[model samples]
Target: MKHLSGKLFISITAYCAISFSSQELAAQSDVLDINEIGNVDISTLLEDTKTFNTIGMGIALSIAECHGKDICEPTVDEGEIGQLIETLDQRIEGVVSRQQNSEEELTPIITAYVDTKEKYADYLERLSEISKPEPELPQEEFVEEDLFTDEDALTEDEYSAFDDFEEDLEDDEDLDEFEDEYDLE
Candidate 1:
């Protein structure tokens, strides 16, 4: 276990050494040495859009195939870095072109959708404003009270009228029949 850990440590150390020392990575990253940090221009580094991408955060595979504690050297040449940058630039250009093409294709469809929505909104507004007659309230038939209508007045006195009503009741045979049936003598 101890030997394995030591081998792992040595491999990692070698990887770091190669990554920091390689002229290929140095040209792109501007980070030539671990100790000479004061030489790195911070403003320039930040301005370079592709600076940090090439700073060798890649997985360290043992390039030289050293078994244990042997010191390893970087083999990444300038040509390899150039090819890698070219490939990335081509891929980015292709992606940007595809995005622009898709935008052009969709613009007309989006515009048509917006126009249809606006037309529907205008139609809805016109439908809302369409006038209809207000429902006619049932004309409350107000018959005029006849203020000058003639009515017959009693010629006889009030007491005499009551006596006449009682005499008529006694002469009615149906009233007598009803009284007999109800046992009212």
Candidate 2:
């Protein structure tokens, strides 16, 4: 029984370690590959255009949300944005070059794609501007001033009366008993 339990524990530990290491490796490899741009075919480009259109619509919605509630923060970082644009440009160039080499009469389609991509880039810029956090105004430090000088202070009798009231409140046995009873330490 002890041997079986020991083997089970070791297996579980090894499985958990392997899972965690794989997840870490996946996270580290989450960068976009620009070289893959050259390998994109027309079918893949068409599919990617649909995705780009969806992304554009999402950006429009984000703009609307920003205008409506002023809280639409950007989901993509600047570095990632730059990488995406670079990859997109590379893909378009690759497609155009390949078409030119093949003597394919479908250059218009590639031109249209480039135009659409340019518009998407413009939208991305607008989204970036819209999602930027507003600059905060500098806060002023508060310095309280003495409202009344020594010559304009309260009279000795009035001060004594206030002190007496404070002392009386502090010495109230009922208040102390109530605080202790309520556990109001």
Model 1 off-target regions past 4 Å?
1-56, 59-72, 104-185
Candidate 2, poorest ten consecutive residues by summed lDDT? 25-34
Residue-pair clash count for candidate 1: 0
> Candidate 2: lDDT of 87?
50
Per-residue lDDT of model 1, residues 1-185, tens digit only: 99779767756765665565444544644342333322434443232223223232221233323323234333333344444445334333433344375543333323332343343344334333334335566655445456445554444696699898888988787788989999998
| Model 1 / residue 68 / CA error / Å | 20
Candidate lDDT values, in order: 0.44, 0.57
Best model per TM-score: 2
**Per-prediction tally of clashes:** 0, 0
Best candidate (score: lDDT): 2
Cα-lDDT of candidate 1: 0.44
Q: Write the per-residue lDDT of candidate 2 for residues 18-85, one digit (tens) a residue.
A: 34533542342232134554444556556555544444454444444455446556444445445546
